[model samples]
Target chain A: MTLLKVEGLRSGYGEVQVLQGLDLTVDAGEIVVVLGANGAGKTTTLRALSGMIPAKGSVQFDGAEVIGRKPEDLVRRGIAHVPQGRGTFPELTVDENLQVGGFTQSAADTAADAERWYEVFPRLAERRDQLAGSMSGGEQQMLAIARALMSRPRLLLLDEPSLGLAPLITRDVFERITEVNQELGTTVLVVEQNANLALKIADRGYVLATGSIVASGTAEELSSDDSVRRAYLGV
Target chain B: MQLFVQRVFDGLQAGAIYAILALAIVIVFRASGMLNIAQGEIAMFTTFIAWNLFDVGLPWWASSVASLVIGFLVGAVLYRLLIVRLGGGHASPLAVVMVTIGLFLMLNDGAAVIWGTTAKPVPRIFGTGRVEIFGAGVAVQVLGLLAVLGVLVVVFGLLFQRTKLGLALRAVTSNQESAALAGIKVTTVLMIGWGLAGAIGSVAGSFTASGNFAVDRNMMQIVLIYAFAAATLGGFDSPLGAVLGGLIIGLVSELVVGYVAIVGPDLRLLPGFALVIIVLLVRPQGMFGSPKVVRA
Candidate 1:
């Protein structure tokens, strides 16, 4: 089942068009990654899809045309976006951060889902009372992902989860993303500059450059492609 | 000793009002990240509404309640009609501050235009009476004001700490983008925050008028200054800090004016403002504010 479908997605900051007619799709139970360098509109794509920016596009989620909807309305439709730079509420406690993630859920469901995510990410559980900002980068990233999961979304959009973490921590984060995909069957569309780690967990990959997908294939195909290896894999 | 105790009581009475107004200031700042220069004038405007209601034979308490509701609507409307159009969180800080200053002048003069210039006498909400606390004869109205302030603090604390709306508010304050992604209506929460501040200002205004035994156009100007000093000392972002800062400022100012011969009643505001300057110099984040923590 196609959980998310985007076509002709035109978006940008005021007067500077970054995403020029971009197109993408994510099946209901697959992990898809969008690989890009800096200024490739990876962040812009997610922002436009999540309704954070005004965009001219057709974003079909669960077969419903949902372009121009507010971010809050999109969340109600089971689309959660973990913004770039790990958009955790820094001043709030870990528990409070999770609570905020469950803004659309009922009180009972929020508590239950929070507990479920805490189990999945034990580090977040250990530092439940501590401020999110005070946590290490790796832990903050985990909390950001966990906070997004608290919404119980069918489709999750992650923007550069490895942007600031150490290489080892980045690998660990990717492993967890794989585990989440297999365990919960949640569709993930993550944009990343760390193409090597992103492709490892990504079932399929799209190479985004200059605002649109220039190359896309199975992870194995992209890893073996000559130009992809030269530019992204560094092999 | 008795004189000292009496002075303490008097300081607390004044402090309670400042504390309420400071809380109002903190509430708006937390939600919008902009200091509302018109907060005091909004209080003044609402107090005039309460005064008019009382003049027309409504009970004093009833009039105050009606004005508070009106104040809430006024605050919400201002946010929707004016602040949102100015780009709200996206607007530059200087632009928003200037708008609030404009609001301050407009509200102040608007009240006078509507109510006329003459000061009208208002009966104290808590009837005039005397109570003794450790041999200090304190007005019952003062005690009542203190009680009201106490209740306001407890309720606001609970609202901020326990409720979903409170969590939404904290989330919005921390990051508007993330809050929206969390499915929280950022604009709605911002509007509620402004409304809550406006409603709180009404309480502060009513108390100020009741304490002075009169309502006039200039009623909240001095109170607003003292409240700003309190917020500055308490930290702009901390609500509890605002309350404690207000009481401490009130107490220090009263004590200084009473004891220092040279710094008489005329210099009552000097000590409080001096303390604010000291706090700003020593700890710019104030007593309870978390220092900005940016991870490299």
Candidate 2:
């Protein structure tokens, strides 16, 4: 039932090695969080797995070894990555952005998915004709998530969904992620610096530091861990 | 008044040709984010193909169609074999520009080697006949060129606005990484963009050859400059803007030649280009291009 399994995921930008022998796994229909501070290789891990960056590692997704594949190939294989900074096509209308996300699907299927996502995010439906760049920060974040979901991916990879949003908006984003996990039973592997909110929604968690996993346990255990509390929660 | 109308007609005919060429430039710019310096040379090469096809017993119309197909294939193949290696993004604008310059020289020389340096007269597709409008006589060729331009506009407008492939191309234009994440094949889109530009260039080249009465190795050299001015003036990002820009630049250049004593005949291109410089100085993004915004 392992949807994604990674072992010794070694990757970096150039000579500077960021991810050194990192390992992680996510079972089907589970919400797993990779919690870390800045420079923890959290984003790098997603980048490598999605083939945006080259890496030497064993990344098995859906029982297939997917190392050295292109990002588009990985996307068609149902691994959708909503990168940090909410990379939305600013000039395109909301509908066009969603259409781009559903590029792999058939016309009818893409349309159906559009309707489904719109029902889930009514604000998106209301502004479907508006340019994505003109939308508010929180609305843009929601559109990014919805755009990623348009592919109907088996596994969703979110990188810092709460990066630049207000506290209330961040809460709304987390709640939506939870709804996606529970309602559709889609597996999620989210990486975030907001340890408190991420761990709350995460079924299991892994703590990363300087490109390596330092500690990992169930969400409850990581929340109660003395070191995690001192460092991340400040409790 | 009749003389003025005649001059305007001549300008429009010239403008239509520039618009087609500018459209080619804009298509490639949208997908690749860099100007294809070889664009004019590619069109020149395709013109030779059309002339050769006519020599081999094909009708002029059939030859023109063949040129379009061949031009598209050549452009796509060139991108796969050469441009793809340069890599995209704003990282190395200089590299792309240089590679295209190299391509321009190679194509220019290649055409000469194959077709020889002598200019050959091209049979007018619309035939050499005169038609009068509002007491001003115009060549049938001028009207034909306008008709072709109109069709090109309608076809391209629909292609960009209504198709799934168009959406994918737009996505690739905005952000390659994000487009790939959306399951779009970025390279494939780039190839299509180049191929479409090539097809358009062939059309423009064919019209230019027939309009000017001949095709040669340097047939597109001066026309390319005008097209560049048109693209830059209209906003490189907007296709409609290219057409309008072409028409305006063409009209202005012609009017300057006809009316201005100081500019004279040889320096007519000067005024049009100077205007482009002024427009760019005022709006660096071009007239219709979106201003770059820095996000927080």
- Which candidate wins on DockQ? 1
Q: Give the TM-score of each candidate.
A: 0.98, 0.97
Model 2 misplaced regions, further than 4 Å: A231-235, B88-91, B293-295
Q: A52 in model 2: Cα distance from truth in Å?
A: 1.0
The TM-scores that each candidate's chain B achieves against the reference are 0.98, 0.96
lDDT of 1 by residue, B1-296 (tens): 88999999889988989999999999999887988888999999999999989999998878888988988988889988889899976667688889999999999888878988889899889898998878888889988888989999999999999988999999999989999999999889999999999999999999999888899889898999999889889998999999999999999999999999999988788999999898889999997776866565
Across residues A188-210, which tens digit of lDDT does each residue of candidate 1 receive? 99998887788889999999888
Q: Look at candidate 2 and give me any clashing residue pairs.
A: none
Docking class of 2: medium
Give Cα distance to truth, residue B271, candidate 1, Å: 0.7
**DockQ of prediction 1:** 0.82
* lDDT of model number 2: 0.89
